[model samples]
Target: MGFSKLFIFLFILQTLLAMALTQPTDQKTNIFREYIGSVSNNVTFADVPINPNVEFHYILAFAIDYTTSSSPHPTDGKFDVFWDTHNFSPSEVTAIKNQHSNVKVALSLGGDSVKKEKCYFSPFSVDSWVSNAVSSLTKIIKEYNLDGIDIDYEQFHADPEIFAKCIGKLITTLKNNGVISFASIAPFDDDEVQSHYLALWKSYGDIIDYVNFQFYAYDKGTTVYQFMNYFHMQSSNYEGGNILVSLTTEGRGGLSPENGFFKACDMLKSEGKLNGIFVWSADTSKGLGFRYEEQSQALLAVSHLHSLV
Candidate 1:
């Protein structure tokens, strides 16, 4: 082969190799999985392995607890970050990230258990629970080379004002320190979490990178119109970048991946109103055979390609 032809062939080979190694980010699809609640029976992290064909913007680890009055984190600003291996393990995390080199391995903080007042909006405090949560979060992000943090504070009943302050300050700190590339919230269709987020966005929306808004759990019998309508309603509160259309696996049924769920996603993608899809869980879905892990990426990819045309 001539030198010029040889150069072209080598370049093509290198490009193909790069594609096999990592996922493309720009003008591509975004899919996320939340490792929350419980994984399916006998389904270990290795059970539902990362599909090389799929690319994920985030694979959120279900959660880490906050230092509460009952279960305090650490006063000396040290946090273990991991325990009860069921939630996560080091090797499992590595495997997930290795699939998509740019995949953001984020940690979800809080759930039904995290107490606000008891922890002073923990992630924002210092030398106390703040130290505990932040220090631990720092440790994990570095240790695992994780990407970001997602706040899944389920206690919307708490003061939205306090919640907003905590959220605003926390994201600001995380982004400023360059410890996390993104920060997100997992909120539902109610005014509880919404109110707090609204308060935060009123002044500090820039700090928030995404909102994995839960479309299931609360919204029963969700139709395509209902799903789009919710997007319209929520998008008013946040920007296009912050809104991620999320669905459930083990919800009140009907609103599933193969059910009306993908239908809703299709409409959103067509209208260009979707950031991406967020599955409420990984394990439960795997157990129930509610698999859309690869489909989510494929759907988004098709949607994106159509938008270009």
Candidate 2:
């Protein structure tokens, strides 16, 4: 071959090698397969009937309340699931996973702490929470055969480093466990949460799957511009892959499906940055033709090539 031809061949070879060296979607498969939703922990799996029509890749069990500190720490694998904490089974997870082959169901830690202070606050700082909670959390994930853990420890005091460190360790350890397929952190469009979580996302983002940002329940992020900005900021932190944008399904959100939510969804989908949509609840939208879940899924169903390279 001539000199120019040989040079072109070498350039192509090097580019292919570089692409090969890069990791999968986020050190794993592409998380943005279809869509994602959350089933509120307020009711048991039995309470909410599954809609055969709706499809989602992930469905996070809304939350688990932290009651007391026992051996292995963090409520001893016993979760306040559904309505009541008493009487539960790991089979619940199996049954849910059995519902959808692609759907991953993981237990979320912490929810709105209106009645209680926080399941993750108080004596447990980032270090303490991770150290103490690891054993029991591991036991739960393994025994339950659950997909992964969702870190929603929102009642943080002043320590962002500990929070991120604790989360980073949890993701690393859980990923090491092998059963935990995915782990996610819940942050909102706030300085405190975003700054701390950005630390984790920047450093150990490869280990985690999605940053399930609570785009509602906050004062701001009501308009299309606001919503776009919120998603943009969250997406900025996560340079790995698509970040899941969760909005309130019930009347909890300020943005309307006919307005801001739809506009943002379209823009994100077109950009190929949209991962999926997560609705705050199943309880409110499951029955009586509420259509909250249905509408959100439809808006997120925007399609584009995963890679044009």
lDDT of 2 at 287: 56
The TM-score measured for candidate 1 stands at 0.76
Per-model TM-score versus the true fold: 0.76, 0.71
Please provide, for model 2 over 70-139, each residue's C-alpha lDDT reduced to its tens digit, 9 standing for 90 to 100: 5322342234543332213566667766865444557777654523444443334556556566666677
For model 1, what is the C-alpha lDDT against the true structure? 0.61
lDDT of 2 at 99: 64
Runs with alpha carbons beyond 4 Å of true place in candidate 1: 1-23, 27-29, 36-42, 49-54, 57-62, 65-87, 114-132, 156-158, 307-309
lDDT of 1 by residue, 1-309 (tens): 999999998997777656543544542245555554334254454445344434455454444544444333412333335323554566666776675464556777665432233222333343244445565677777776777888766554346766676556667776788999877777776666677667767767777777777777555676766667777888886764458777666666336554577888777776766666777676567766545765676676555444433
- lDDT against true structure, model 2: 0.57
**Considering only N, C-alpha and C atoms within 3 Å, which residue pairs clash in candidate 1?**
67-73
Best candidate, lDDT-wise? Answer: 1
Q: Once model 2 is optimally superposed onto the true structure by TM-score, how far is the C-alpha of residue 121 displaced, in angstroms?
A: 3.3
Clashing pairs in 2: none
